[model samples]
Target: MRTSPFGRTALSFGFFLLPLFCRGSHSARNQTANVTLDASFVVVEEYAFGIQGVWVQHREPTNCTQSPEKPRTRDITPAQCNRTCFPGSFQPPRLSDCNKIIESLLNNNTGSLQANPHTWVYVYYESCVAVFENPDEDSPTLQYNWAVLGANVKSLVNSCLSTPDQNSIGGACVFDEYDGKQLSNVEVAVQRFTDFDDDHDDDE
Candidate 1:
């Protein structure tokens, strides 16, 4: 699940480009390291969903001993982590579009979640990408995209649509709740699968 250099470069470029329209402040530029970008999967004319994020890996110390000479404590950081989602493998569902949808709704003064209770949101992988979708029947569509450095097309169906096993990459699902703190026991099964740029205003 190594991230391709092309993907990394595209993501890095996307990071710097996002700040211009996002916050339009000096802080936004410096905050790229922690920034999360929203994107969608495009599936013909029916559905397009994706996640809004950057796959970030934070290092933690290990508990394994480096050598017998020192007899010191070491830590084995699991290569797999919940915070990090890699391409080509369905890591556990680490990203969600619930907040993004909520934010979009609020920005347009779309009232509250209670007003529109029939909601479904999720994050899935397609053609190596981790996509999240929340379609709006009431409004015109908007386009937001991000490049996933290590996306792959393996098990795109099982991970997203079929009943996944212990090793499957099926996405995480959330419902009407804006915070999405309470997760549904049943993950949303998608029947189909398919599917950014930035300018620093005056700068590149």
Candidate 2:
């Protein structure tokens, strides 16, 4: 894996300062690109369970590369990630009305609550929609269930109800736990690759 210039610094100090920076930005509705998808995901995840700070990450196709080997891991604010490869749009509700929006989005799918077609990058949500949209695929692992959305909503609500004070919602609390878990795993893998490359250069 290839590491961007921001990776090492991020590994050094990003996690510790995350909450502070996140708190500074109440909403990403108008912010250009100072927040990253990963960080914004954290902010939105927190907001879902009634925590504050909602940040969104918007990226153009050119901001990210499709290749897995040359992954872009940056420590800078989302605005500075000119060459970062991870791309997506993440919109979270404001802190004041997060609960209301969450409730509506999860419980009342009155066509008004449809996921953003252009921004719905999370695979689990897409897969659930796909199972409904394309019955001909005959996906063995994912059966077509009309109650899929309800089930996910129930699970997320239960998680929030169980632990409202937990600063970070664990894996089970997310719309799709796998998305966070997979992203985390990829970050770790990228870090290890960076370490290996550094060691190799030192030896040479």
Candidate 3:
């Protein structure tokens, strides 16, 4: 049986995290009293049946013996985890609407939205609709060439916030992020919830 790209990525990630997990376990064992570790956040890429989507996992803190061997993770709902969770204040784009857009793109049924034959699109939580040029035939591998589509982000958020009916939002929008550069891999683009500071001046 062939391993899917998603499986391969997960296996690799697991291997990369083995040492960290070991260290965490060791530390837990040595603690005199039960110690609670900080919660971890990750953006997971899920691909199955040739369809890809992203979701956020908020791993709750673990207290050595009180918690199970594996830390518990809570899958954050799109509504709860959005731009509002970040430092900068902005109305977050509705993830349900973004899901519709991704579905349309995957089914090749985008009505007004035109994506290049060589481009692939997916949503990065409530942040933005990420677009990337399909890797060349020579590469044939899906590279992490994704970049945020500013125009699409604006349109989607505006539509979701202003329009009462979400059913009409997906097909009516246009997607154009061809010139976008400074791409990053979807896997490494994980958002850290613990890194935000109340006094920080930077805005998203």
Candidate 4:
């Protein structure tokens, strides 16, 4: 299936992250506003999604006595592993409002907010990365095809996070280092999570 520019598989995920493009900050826009953000007081722990959106490093189970260099792959029936989990399938942290998150960031003027672009990109991508669990939606192939998913995520990041020109909403957003083969290593790593046997035949 052709995915959305935001890599959300044409699902609700696109809608969920929609506010990213709206405006910088209402406080920043309104000159008379009395609000001021204190980045120093902002606790990293308060950002539940940011802290939890981590990928668990894969390890061979102790039950497996064999060489981990040649790990086993699942031949799960369609009924068992019926669906692939899109990034949207996994529950986002207790974050009920993206606006609140934005407002909080806007208010912060201390050390925490110093790395704006890097911070923005980091949390944004990690929120999506949190959905990399095994798929719950049915797929003809295994859900962990790193090439496919990584490519899709990259597309989504570019589509959703990039800033657009104010006068031309449809015009291209500014390009960055995220383009091209940047996801190659990610794809290679994700291949380990799937049952993709290139030589296996239908008869096998």
lDDT of each: 0.23, 0.21, 0.26, 0.22
**For candidate 3, lDDT tens digit of each residue in 94-160?**
4553544344344432122222211232333333233322211121223221122333334444544
**Candidate 1: tens digits of C-alpha lDDT, residues 49-143:** 22344221111112111222422211111111122112223222222322332223224331111111111222222212233222222311112
Best by lDDT: 3
| Candidate numbers sorted by TM-score from highest down | 2, 3, 4, 1
- Top candidate when judged by TM-score against the true structure: 2
TM-score of 3: 0.21
Q: TM-score of the candidate numbered 2?
A: 0.25
Off by over 4 Å in 2: 1-61, 64-98, 107-151, 164-204
TM-score, one value per model: 0.19, 0.25, 0.21, 0.21
**lDDT agreement of model 2 with the native:** 0.21
Local accuracy of candidate 4 as per-residue lDDT tens digits, 18-40 = 11211122222211221222222
Indicate the worst ten consecutive residues by lDDT in candidate 2: 126-135
Estimate candidate 1's alpha-carbon lDDT, on a 0 to 1 scale. 0.23
- Model 3: lDDT equals 0.26
Q: Model 4, 120: alpha-carbon shift in Å?
A: 24
Error of 2 at 94 (Å): 11
Task: Give candidate 4 misplaced runs (Cα > 4 Å).
Answer: 1-54, 57-130, 133-143, 164-204
